[model samples]
Target: MAAWLGWQIESNWADPFVFAIYSLVKPLAGALILVFMYAVIAKDGLHSPLFPGVFVGNALFIYVPAVLAGISWTIIDDREHYGMLKYVYTAPVNVFAYLIGRGVAKAIVATVAVVIMLLLGTLALGVPVRLAGINWLFVAATLVLGSAMLSLFGILLGGVTMITARHNYGVGEAVAGGLYLLCGVVFPLDTLPAWLAATGRVIPISYWLEAFRRALLGHGTEAFASLSDGVLLAVIAGSTAVLAVLAVLGFRLAERRARAKGLLDMQTMY
Candidate 1:
Protein backbone atom coordinates (compact mmCIF):
# COMPACT_ATOMS: atom_id res chain seq x y z
CA MET A 1 0.00 0.00 0.00
CA ALA A 2 2.82 2.39 0.75
CA ALA A 3 4.47 1.51 -2.52
CA TRP A 4 1.21 2.00 -4.34
CA LEU A 5 0.77 5.41 -2.76
CA GLY A 6 4.30 6.36 -3.74
CA TRP A 7 3.80 5.25 -7.32
CA GLN A 8 0.60 7.19 -7.57
CA ILE A 9 2.26 10.32 -6.20
CA GLU A 10 5.11 10.05 -8.67
CA SER A 11 3.20 9.05 -11.79
CA ASN A 12 -0.01 11.04 -11.40
CA TRP A 13 1.72 14.36 -12.00
CA ALA A 14 1.32 14.04 -15.76
CA ASP A 15 -0.26 12.01 -18.50
CA PRO A 16 1.62 8.89 -19.52
CA PHE A 17 2.93 10.47 -22.73
CA VAL A 18 4.17 13.58 -20.97
CA PHE A 19 5.71 11.63 -18.11
CA ALA A 20 7.47 9.28 -20.51
CA ILE A 21 8.80 12.17 -22.53
CA TYR A 22 10.01 13.94 -19.43
CA SER A 23 11.81 10.80 -18.36
CA LEU A 24 13.53 10.39 -21.70
CA VAL A 25 14.36 14.03 -22.30
CA LYS A 26 15.88 14.72 -18.90
CA PRO A 27 18.29 11.79 -18.94
CA LEU A 28 19.02 12.33 -22.60
CA ALA A 29 19.96 15.95 -22.00
CA GLY A 30 22.19 14.96 -19.08
CA ALA A 31 23.89 12.27 -21.17
CA LEU A 32 24.42 14.69 -24.03
CA ILE A 33 26.23 17.09 -21.74
CA LEU A 34 28.64 14.32 -20.78
CA VAL A 35 28.96 13.28 -24.43
CA PHE A 36 29.89 16.80 -25.45
CA MET A 37 32.40 17.06 -22.63
CA TYR A 38 33.97 13.75 -23.63
CA ALA A 39 34.13 14.84 -27.23
CA VAL A 40 36.02 17.98 -26.37
CA ILE A 41 38.49 16.31 -23.98
CA ALA A 42 39.27 13.00 -25.68
CA LYS A 43 40.89 13.17 -29.08
CA ASP A 44 39.19 9.95 -30.14
CA GLY A 45 35.82 11.26 -28.97
CA LEU A 46 33.15 8.58 -28.49
CA HIS A 47 35.40 5.98 -30.04
CA SER A 48 37.94 6.18 -27.25
CA PRO A 49 38.29 3.06 -25.11
CA LEU A 50 37.45 5.12 -22.04
CA PHE A 51 34.10 6.18 -23.51
CA PRO A 52 32.13 3.07 -22.61
CA GLY A 53 33.07 3.09 -18.94
CA VAL A 54 32.43 6.79 -18.62
CA PHE A 55 29.16 6.56 -20.50
CA VAL A 56 27.87 3.63 -18.52
CA GLY A 57 28.97 5.18 -15.25
CA ASN A 58 27.18 8.42 -16.00
CA ALA A 59 24.13 6.52 -17.16
CA LEU A 60 23.83 4.65 -13.89
CA PHE A 61 24.72 7.54 -11.57
CA ILE A 62 21.24 9.06 -11.89
CA TYR A 63 20.00 6.79 -9.12
CA VAL A 64 22.14 8.58 -6.56
CA PRO A 65 20.19 11.82 -6.75
CA ALA A 66 16.85 10.13 -7.37
CA VAL A 67 16.81 7.77 -4.40
CA LEU A 68 18.62 10.05 -1.97
CA ALA A 69 16.58 13.15 -2.67
CA GLY A 70 13.34 11.30 -3.30
CA ILE A 71 13.11 9.61 0.10
CA SER A 72 14.40 12.55 2.08
CA TRP A 73 12.06 14.94 0.33
CA THR A 74 9.07 12.94 1.51
CA ILE A 75 9.44 14.25 5.04
CA ILE A 76 9.78 17.83 3.90
CA ASP A 77 7.01 17.54 1.37
CA ASP A 78 4.49 15.98 3.70
CA ARG A 79 5.31 18.39 6.50
CA GLU A 80 5.88 21.62 4.64
CA HIS A 81 3.96 21.30 1.41
CA TYR A 82 0.93 19.30 2.45
CA GLY A 83 1.01 20.00 6.18
CA MET A 84 0.01 16.42 6.94
CA LEU A 85 3.15 15.01 8.47
CA LYS A 86 1.67 15.00 11.96
CA TYR A 87 -1.26 13.06 10.67
CA VAL A 88 1.07 10.73 8.81
CA TYR A 89 2.99 10.08 12.02
CA THR A 90 -0.18 9.23 13.92
CA ALA A 91 -1.41 6.92 11.19
CA PRO A 92 -1.02 3.18 11.66
CA VAL A 93 1.75 2.75 9.13
CA ASN A 94 5.43 2.02 9.49
CA VAL A 95 7.08 5.33 8.73
CA PHE A 96 10.34 3.66 7.83
CA ALA A 97 8.61 1.37 5.38
CA TYR A 98 6.73 4.33 3.91
CA LEU A 99 9.98 6.22 3.36
CA ILE A 100 11.59 3.19 1.78
CA GLY A 101 8.57 2.70 -0.42
CA ARG A 102 8.92 6.29 -1.60
CA GLY A 103 12.54 5.67 -2.40
CA VAL A 104 11.48 2.54 -4.28
CA ALA A 105 9.33 4.72 -6.52
CA LYS A 106 12.34 6.84 -7.38
CA ALA A 107 14.38 3.69 -7.95
CA ILE A 108 11.78 2.44 -10.40
CA VAL A 109 11.96 5.68 -12.36
CA ALA A 110 15.73 5.73 -12.23
CA THR A 111 15.82 2.22 -13.64
CA VAL A 112 13.72 3.30 -16.58
CA ALA A 113 15.95 6.33 -17.14
CA VAL A 114 18.99 4.07 -16.99
CA VAL A 115 17.53 1.74 -19.58
CA ILE A 116 16.76 4.62 -21.91
CA MET A 117 20.29 5.97 -21.57
CA LEU A 118 21.81 2.53 -22.12
CA LEU A 119 19.70 1.96 -25.20
CA LEU A 120 20.63 5.38 -26.56
CA GLY A 121 24.28 4.81 -25.85
CA THR A 122 24.26 1.42 -27.50
CA LEU A 123 22.36 2.36 -30.63
CA ALA A 124 23.41 5.93 -31.38
CA LEU A 125 26.46 6.81 -29.30
CA GLY A 126 28.26 3.53 -29.97
CA VAL A 127 28.78 2.42 -26.37
CA PRO A 128 29.37 -1.18 -27.50
CA VAL A 129 26.97 -2.71 -24.99
CA ARG A 130 25.34 -6.03 -25.81
CA LEU A 131 22.40 -7.33 -23.78
CA ALA A 132 23.51 -10.90 -24.49
CA GLY A 133 26.93 -10.19 -23.02
CA ILE A 134 25.76 -8.77 -19.70
CA ASN A 135 26.09 -10.73 -16.47
CA TRP A 136 22.51 -10.53 -15.29
CA LEU A 137 23.15 -12.17 -11.92
CA PHE A 138 26.01 -9.89 -10.97
CA VAL A 139 24.14 -6.83 -12.16
CA ALA A 140 21.11 -7.84 -10.13
CA ALA A 141 23.14 -8.36 -6.98
CA THR A 142 25.00 -5.11 -7.43
CA LEU A 143 21.80 -3.17 -8.07
CA VAL A 144 20.12 -4.60 -4.97
CA LEU A 145 23.09 -3.98 -2.70
CA GLY A 146 23.74 -0.52 -4.09
CA SER A 147 20.10 0.55 -3.93
CA ALA A 148 19.69 -0.75 -0.37
CA MET A 149 22.76 1.13 0.77
CA LEU A 150 21.62 4.33 -0.94
CA SER A 151 18.12 4.01 0.50
CA LEU A 152 19.56 3.66 3.97
CA PHE A 153 21.54 6.80 3.43
CA GLY A 154 18.37 8.51 2.29
CA ILE A 155 16.53 7.37 5.41
CA LEU A 156 19.30 8.69 7.57
CA LEU A 157 19.08 12.00 5.78
CA GLY A 158 15.30 12.05 6.11
CA GLY A 159 15.58 11.41 9.83
CA VAL A 160 17.99 14.29 10.16
CA THR A 161 15.76 16.49 8.06
CA MET A 162 12.89 15.78 10.41
CA ILE A 163 14.68 17.60 13.23
CA THR A 164 15.98 20.50 11.24
CA ALA A 165 14.03 23.73 11.67
CA ARG A 166 15.19 25.03 8.32
CA HIS A 167 14.92 23.64 4.82
CA ASN A 168 17.83 21.46 3.76
CA TYR A 169 16.97 19.89 0.48
CA GLY A 170 20.43 20.78 -0.78
CA VAL A 171 21.91 18.21 1.58
CA GLY A 172 20.93 15.37 -0.66
CA GLU A 173 22.24 17.11 -3.79
CA ALA A 174 25.51 17.91 -2.03
CA VAL A 175 25.93 14.28 -1.05
CA ALA A 176 25.19 13.18 -4.60
CA GLY A 177 27.83 15.52 -5.99
CA GLY A 178 30.32 14.28 -3.43
CA LEU A 179 29.57 10.70 -4.41
CA TYR A 180 29.90 11.47 -8.11
CA LEU A 181 33.45 12.69 -7.59
CA LEU A 182 34.46 10.20 -4.90
CA CYS A 183 32.85 7.09 -6.43
CA GLY A 184 34.53 7.34 -9.85
CA VAL A 185 31.29 7.81 -11.70
CA VAL A 186 32.96 9.46 -14.67
CA PHE A 187 36.63 8.99 -13.87
CA PRO A 188 38.80 6.33 -12.28
CA LEU A 189 39.53 6.74 -8.58
CA ASP A 190 43.21 6.25 -9.22
CA THR A 191 43.18 9.48 -11.17
CA LEU A 192 42.24 11.39 -8.02
CA PRO A 193 44.73 12.63 -5.40
CA ALA A 194 46.18 9.85 -3.23
CA TRP A 195 44.17 10.86 -0.13
CA LEU A 196 40.99 11.30 -2.14
CA ALA A 197 41.48 8.00 -3.90
CA ALA A 198 41.96 6.27 -0.56
CA THR A 199 38.72 7.83 0.68
CA GLY A 200 36.96 6.57 -2.44
CA ARG A 201 38.32 3.10 -1.84
CA VAL A 202 36.48 2.88 1.48
CA ILE A 203 33.11 3.89 0.03
CA PRO A 204 30.82 0.96 -0.80
CA ILE A 205 29.46 2.71 -3.88
CA SER A 206 32.92 2.75 -5.44
CA TYR A 207 33.14 -1.01 -5.16
CA TRP A 208 29.52 -1.32 -6.25
CA LEU A 209 30.14 0.69 -9.41
CA GLU A 210 33.30 -1.26 -10.15
CA ALA A 211 31.35 -4.48 -9.83
CA PHE A 212 28.55 -3.07 -11.96
CA ARG A 213 30.95 -1.90 -14.64
CA ARG A 214 32.55 -5.30 -14.84
CA ALA A 215 29.14 -6.90 -15.04
CA LEU A 216 28.14 -4.76 -17.99
CA LEU A 217 31.41 -4.51 -19.88
CA GLY A 218 33.17 -7.67 -18.69
CA HIS A 219 35.86 -5.34 -17.37
CA GLY A 220 36.14 -2.17 -15.36
CA THR A 221 38.63 0.53 -14.44
CA GLU A 222 42.17 -0.56 -13.55
CA ALA A 223 41.77 1.12 -10.16
CA PHE A 224 39.97 -1.98 -8.90
CA ALA A 225 41.20 -4.53 -11.41
CA SER A 226 43.32 -6.18 -8.72
CA LEU A 227 40.26 -7.11 -6.63
CA SER A 228 38.48 -10.29 -7.60
CA ASP A 229 34.71 -10.31 -8.14
CA GLY A 230 34.23 -12.11 -4.83
CA VAL A 231 36.16 -9.44 -2.98
CA LEU A 232 34.15 -6.65 -4.56
CA LEU A 233 30.87 -8.33 -3.75
CA ALA A 234 32.05 -8.95 -0.20
CA VAL A 235 32.91 -5.32 0.35
CA ILE A 236 29.55 -4.18 -0.95
CA ALA A 237 27.58 -6.65 1.17
CA GLY A 238 29.60 -6.00 4.33
CA SER A 239 29.41 -2.22 4.04
CA THR A 240 25.68 -2.36 3.37
CA ALA A 241 25.20 -4.47 6.49
CA VAL A 242 27.11 -1.96 8.57
CA LEU A 243 25.24 0.98 7.09
CA ALA A 244 21.88 -0.71 7.71
CA VAL A 245 22.59 -0.82 11.44
CA LEU A 246 23.69 2.79 11.53
CA ALA A 247 20.73 4.07 9.53
CA VAL A 248 18.27 2.25 11.79
CA LEU A 249 19.84 3.48 14.99
CA GLY A 250 20.27 7.02 13.74
CA PHE A 251 16.72 7.23 12.42
CA ARG A 252 15.24 5.91 15.67
CA LEU A 253 17.20 8.43 17.67
CA ALA A 254 16.14 11.18 15.33
CA GLU A 255 12.55 10.09 15.64
CA ARG A 256 12.76 10.19 19.41
CA ARG A 257 14.35 13.61 19.35
CA ALA A 258 11.77 14.91 16.93
CA ARG A 259 8.96 13.64 19.12
CA ALA A 260 10.48 14.99 22.33
CA LYS A 261 11.04 18.38 20.77
CA GLY A 262 7.66 18.38 19.05
CA LEU A 263 9.36 19.15 15.74
CA LEU A 264 7.60 16.59 13.57
CA ASP A 265 4.78 18.97 12.82
CA MET A 266 6.89 22.11 12.62
CA GLN A 267 6.99 23.79 9.24
CA THR A 268 9.46 26.21 7.76
CA MET A 269 7.58 28.36 5.30
CA TYR A 270 10.69 28.62 3.15
Candidate 2:
Protein backbone atom coordinates (compact mmCIF):
# COMPACT_ATOMS: atom_id res chain seq x y z
CA MET A 1 0.00 0.00 0.00
CA ALA A 2 2.82 2.39 0.82
CA ALA A 3 4.53 1.45 -2.41
CA TRP A 4 1.32 2.10 -4.30
CA LEU A 5 0.97 5.47 -2.64
CA GLY A 6 4.54 6.33 -3.46
CA TRP A 7 4.07 5.44 -7.12
CA GLN A 8 0.91 7.48 -7.32
CA ILE A 9 2.64 10.46 -5.75
CA GLU A 10 5.68 10.16 -8.01
CA SER A 11 3.74 9.73 -11.25
CA ASN A 12 0.89 12.16 -10.56
CA TRP A 13 3.04 15.03 -11.74
CA ALA A 14 2.82 13.91 -15.39
CA ASP A 15 1.08 11.43 -17.64
CA PRO A 16 2.70 8.12 -18.48
CA PHE A 17 4.10 9.03 -21.88
CA VAL A 18 5.48 12.36 -20.76
CA PHE A 19 6.88 10.83 -17.62
CA ALA A 20 8.64 8.15 -19.63
CA ILE A 21 10.14 10.73 -21.94
CA TYR A 22 11.31 12.79 -19.01
CA SER A 23 12.92 9.76 -17.43
CA LEU A 24 14.82 8.94 -20.61
CA VAL A 25 15.98 12.50 -21.12
CA LYS A 26 17.19 13.17 -17.60
CA PRO A 27 19.78 10.40 -17.53
CA LEU A 28 20.98 11.08 -21.06
CA ALA A 29 21.64 14.70 -20.26
CA GLY A 30 23.80 13.61 -17.36
CA ALA A 31 25.59 11.10 -19.56
CA LEU A 32 26.38 13.73 -22.16
CA ILE A 33 28.57 15.55 -19.65
CA LEU A 34 30.67 12.44 -19.25
CA VAL A 35 30.64 11.80 -22.99
CA PHE A 36 31.98 15.27 -23.73
CA MET A 37 34.63 14.90 -21.08
CA TYR A 38 35.80 11.60 -22.57
CA ALA A 39 35.75 12.96 -26.09
CA VAL A 40 38.15 15.70 -25.12
CA ILE A 41 40.72 13.43 -23.44
CA ALA A 42 40.59 10.02 -25.10
CA LYS A 43 42.11 9.54 -28.55
CA ASP A 44 39.83 6.54 -29.09
CA GLY A 45 36.76 8.43 -27.85
CA LEU A 46 33.66 6.23 -27.41
CA HIS A 47 35.37 3.28 -29.08
CA SER A 48 38.01 2.89 -26.40
CA PRO A 49 38.07 -0.35 -24.41
CA LEU A 50 37.64 1.67 -21.22
CA PHE A 51 34.59 3.52 -22.57
CA PRO A 52 32.21 0.58 -22.12
CA GLY A 53 32.93 0.31 -18.39
CA VAL A 54 32.71 4.06 -17.99
CA PHE A 55 29.48 4.18 -19.97
CA VAL A 56 27.90 1.27 -18.11
CA GLY A 57 29.09 2.56 -14.74
CA ASN A 58 27.56 6.00 -15.14
CA ALA A 59 24.40 4.55 -16.64
CA LEU A 60 23.91 1.99 -13.88
CA PHE A 61 24.59 4.58 -11.16
CA ILE A 62 21.11 6.10 -11.55
CA TYR A 63 19.98 3.95 -8.63
CA VAL A 64 22.35 5.56 -6.16
CA PRO A 65 20.78 9.02 -6.19
CA ALA A 66 17.29 7.81 -7.00
CA VAL A 67 17.02 5.17 -4.30
CA LEU A 68 19.30 6.76 -1.72
CA ALA A 69 17.77 10.23 -1.88
CA GLY A 70 14.28 9.08 -2.82
CA ILE A 71 13.62 7.34 0.50
CA SER A 72 15.02 10.22 2.54
CA TRP A 73 12.94 12.61 0.43
CA THR A 74 9.84 10.74 1.56
CA ILE A 75 10.33 11.91 5.12
CA ILE A 76 10.62 15.52 4.04
CA ASP A 77 7.79 15.26 1.52
CA ASP A 78 5.22 13.72 3.88
CA ARG A 79 6.04 15.83 6.91
CA GLU A 80 6.69 19.18 5.28
CA HIS A 81 4.85 19.11 1.98
CA TYR A 82 1.75 17.07 2.77
CA GLY A 83 1.82 17.34 6.57
CA MET A 84 0.46 13.79 6.82
CA LEU A 85 3.25 12.21 8.83
CA LYS A 86 1.42 12.54 12.12
CA TYR A 87 -1.47 10.60 10.66
CA VAL A 88 0.97 7.94 9.51
CA TYR A 89 2.10 7.50 13.09
CA THR A 90 -1.50 7.21 14.29
CA ALA A 91 -2.20 4.55 11.68
CA PRO A 92 -1.45 0.86 12.19
CA VAL A 93 1.15 0.60 9.45
CA ASN A 94 4.71 -0.25 10.44
CA VAL A 95 7.11 2.65 9.85
CA PHE A 96 10.03 0.48 8.79
CA ALA A 97 7.92 -1.46 6.31
CA TYR A 98 6.43 1.74 4.98
CA LEU A 99 9.89 3.23 4.37
CA ILE A 100 11.00 0.06 2.62
CA GLY A 101 7.94 0.18 0.42
CA ARG A 102 8.69 3.77 -0.47
CA GLY A 103 12.25 2.87 -1.31
CA VAL A 104 11.04 0.01 -3.50
CA ALA A 105 8.81 2.36 -5.42
CA LYS A 106 11.82 4.51 -6.21
CA ALA A 107 13.79 1.43 -7.17
CA ILE A 108 11.10 0.47 -9.63
CA VAL A 109 11.41 3.88 -11.24
CA ALA A 110 15.17 3.65 -11.23
CA THR A 111 14.96 0.28 -12.95
CA VAL A 112 13.11 1.89 -15.80
CA ALA A 113 15.70 4.62 -16.04
CA VAL A 114 18.47 2.02 -15.97
CA VAL A 115 16.95 -0.05 -18.76
CA ILE A 116 16.45 3.01 -20.88
CA MET A 117 20.02 4.14 -20.26
CA LEU A 118 21.46 0.72 -21.10
CA LEU A 119 19.46 0.41 -24.29
CA LEU A 120 20.40 3.88 -25.39
CA GLY A 121 24.02 3.36 -24.48
CA THR A 122 24.17 0.23 -26.61
CA LEU A 123 22.34 1.53 -29.70
CA ALA A 124 23.34 5.16 -29.70
CA LEU A 125 26.71 5.25 -27.98
CA GLY A 126 27.99 1.80 -29.01
CA VAL A 127 28.68 0.65 -25.46
CA PRO A 128 29.39 -2.87 -26.88
CA VAL A 129 27.17 -4.90 -24.52
CA ARG A 130 26.03 -7.94 -26.48
CA LEU A 131 23.10 -9.86 -25.00
CA ALA A 132 24.74 -13.21 -25.68
CA GLY A 133 27.89 -12.26 -23.81
CA ILE A 134 26.13 -10.88 -20.74
CA ASN A 135 25.83 -12.68 -17.43
CA TRP A 136 22.19 -12.59 -16.38
CA LEU A 137 22.88 -14.12 -12.98
CA PHE A 138 25.39 -11.47 -12.04
CA VAL A 139 23.08 -8.70 -13.17
CA ALA A 140 20.18 -10.13 -11.19
CA ALA A 141 22.23 -10.64 -8.04
CA THR A 142 23.84 -7.23 -8.24
CA LEU A 143 20.51 -5.47 -8.75
CA VAL A 144 18.83 -7.28 -5.86
CA LEU A 145 21.73 -7.09 -3.40
CA GLY A 146 22.75 -3.59 -4.43
CA SER A 147 19.22 -2.24 -4.23
CA ALA A 148 18.72 -3.78 -0.79
CA MET A 149 21.96 -2.27 0.46
CA LEU A 150 20.99 1.13 -0.92
CA SER A 151 17.53 0.89 0.66
CA LEU A 152 19.07 0.25 4.05
CA PHE A 153 21.35 3.21 3.55
CA GLY A 154 18.29 5.21 2.53
CA ILE A 155 16.39 4.18 5.65
CA LEU A 156 19.37 5.19 7.77
CA LEU A 157 19.32 8.60 6.08
CA GLY A 158 15.54 8.83 6.47
CA GLY A 159 15.99 8.17 10.17
CA VAL A 160 18.38 11.08 10.35
CA THR A 161 15.92 13.25 8.43
CA MET A 162 13.13 12.27 10.83
CA ILE A 163 14.83 14.30 13.56
CA THR A 164 16.34 17.05 11.45
CA ALA A 165 14.70 20.30 10.28
CA ARG A 166 12.82 20.94 7.04
CA HIS A 167 15.76 22.75 5.52
CA ASN A 168 17.69 19.49 5.61
CA TYR A 169 16.27 18.42 2.27
CA GLY A 170 19.72 18.18 0.68
CA VAL A 171 21.07 15.65 3.18
CA GLY A 172 20.45 12.57 1.08
CA GLU A 173 21.73 14.10 -2.16
CA ALA A 174 24.87 15.29 -0.38
CA VAL A 175 25.53 11.75 0.76
CA ALA A 176 24.86 10.40 -2.74
CA GLY A 177 27.27 12.93 -4.24
CA GLY A 178 29.88 11.90 -1.72
CA LEU A 179 29.41 8.26 -2.68
CA TYR A 180 29.72 9.15 -6.38
CA LEU A 181 33.17 10.47 -5.70
CA LEU A 182 34.20 7.62 -3.44
CA CYS A 183 32.53 4.64 -5.19
CA GLY A 184 34.31 4.68 -8.55
CA VAL A 185 31.23 5.58 -10.53
CA VAL A 186 32.80 7.06 -13.72
CA PHE A 187 36.48 6.33 -13.04
CA PRO A 188 38.62 3.66 -11.43
CA LEU A 189 39.36 4.03 -7.71
CA ASP A 190 43.05 3.57 -8.56
CA THR A 191 42.98 7.12 -9.94
CA LEU A 192 42.41 8.47 -6.45
CA PRO A 193 44.94 8.95 -3.65
CA ALA A 194 45.92 5.83 -1.68
CA TRP A 195 43.79 6.74 1.35
CA LEU A 196 40.70 7.52 -0.76
CA ALA A 197 41.25 4.30 -2.74
CA ALA A 198 41.33 2.36 0.54
CA THR A 199 38.11 4.06 1.66
CA GLY A 200 36.39 3.24 -1.64
CA ARG A 201 37.42 -0.39 -1.32
CA VAL A 202 35.56 -0.62 1.99
CA ILE A 203 32.28 0.56 0.42
CA PRO A 204 29.95 -2.18 -0.78
CA ILE A 205 28.84 -0.19 -3.82
CA SER A 206 32.38 -0.29 -5.11
CA TYR A 207 32.14 -4.03 -5.40
CA TRP A 208 28.59 -3.80 -6.66
CA LEU A 209 29.59 -1.53 -9.57
CA GLU A 210 32.54 -3.74 -10.39
CA ALA A 211 30.29 -6.75 -10.58
CA PHE A 212 27.70 -4.85 -12.59
CA ARG A 213 30.27 -3.80 -15.20
CA ARG A 214 31.56 -7.32 -15.62
CA ALA A 215 28.02 -8.64 -15.90
CA LEU A 216 27.26 -6.34 -18.81
CA LEU A 217 30.59 -5.77 -20.54
CA GLY A 218 32.35 -9.08 -19.80
CA HIS A 219 34.94 -7.28 -17.68
CA GLY A 220 35.22 -4.52 -15.09
CA THR A 221 37.57 -1.65 -14.34
CA GLU A 222 41.19 -2.16 -13.38
CA ALA A 223 40.46 -1.24 -9.77
CA PHE A 224 39.23 -4.72 -8.86
CA ALA A 225 40.31 -6.56 -11.99
CA SER A 226 42.39 -8.99 -9.94
CA LEU A 227 39.42 -10.43 -8.05
CA SER A 228 37.24 -13.05 -9.69
CA ASP A 229 33.49 -12.57 -10.18
CA GLY A 230 32.66 -14.84 -7.22
CA VAL A 231 34.77 -12.83 -4.80
CA LEU A 232 33.12 -9.59 -5.84
CA LEU A 233 29.64 -11.03 -5.32
CA ALA A 234 30.69 -12.37 -1.91
CA VAL A 235 31.88 -8.97 -0.80
CA ILE A 236 28.64 -7.30 -1.91
CA ALA A 237 26.48 -9.83 -0.04
CA GLY A 238 28.56 -9.76 3.16
CA SER A 239 28.70 -5.97 3.30
CA THR A 240 24.95 -5.73 2.76
CA ALA A 241 24.35 -8.12 5.64
CA VAL A 242 26.45 -5.96 7.96
CA LEU A 243 24.68 -2.83 6.75
CA ALA A 244 21.26 -4.38 7.44
CA VAL A 245 22.01 -4.68 11.16
CA LEU A 246 23.39 -1.17 11.47
CA ALA A 247 20.55 0.41 9.52
CA VAL A 248 17.90 -1.27 11.62
CA LEU A 249 19.55 -0.38 14.91
CA GLY A 250 20.28 3.19 13.89
CA PHE A 251 16.76 3.74 12.58
CA ARG A 252 15.25 2.45 15.81
CA LEU A 253 17.28 4.87 17.89
CA ALA A 254 16.43 7.74 15.57
CA GLU A 255 12.75 6.88 15.71
CA ARG A 256 12.86 6.80 19.50
CA ARG A 257 14.47 10.20 19.59
CA ALA A 258 12.02 11.65 17.09
CA ARG A 259 9.02 10.34 18.99
CA ALA A 260 10.38 11.49 22.33
CA LYS A 261 11.11 14.97 20.99
CA GLY A 262 7.79 15.26 19.15
CA LEU A 263 9.53 15.71 15.83
CA LEU A 264 7.40 13.35 13.82
CA ASP A 265 4.40 15.60 14.04
CA MET A 266 6.40 18.80 14.31
CA GLN A 267 6.61 20.95 11.18
CA THR A 268 8.97 23.81 10.57
CA MET A 269 7.66 26.38 8.11
CA TYR A 270 11.00 26.67 6.33
Per-model lDDT? 0.88, 0.88
How far residue 240's Cα lies from its native spot in candidate 1, in Å, is 0.5
Pairs in clash, predicted candidate 1:
none
Steric clash pairs (candidate 2): none
TM-score of each: 0.96, 0.96
> Which tens-of-lDDT digit does each residue in 42-109 have in candidate 1?
89998988889988998988888889878888888888888988998899988889999988888888
**Cα lDDT over the full model 2:** 0.88
lDDT of 2 by residue, 140-253 (tens): 999899989999999889989999995578899899888899998988788889999999999898899999999999988888988999999899999999999998999899
Q: Which stretches of candidate 2 lie over 4 Å from their true place?
A: none
* Candidate 1: clashing residue pairs, number: 0
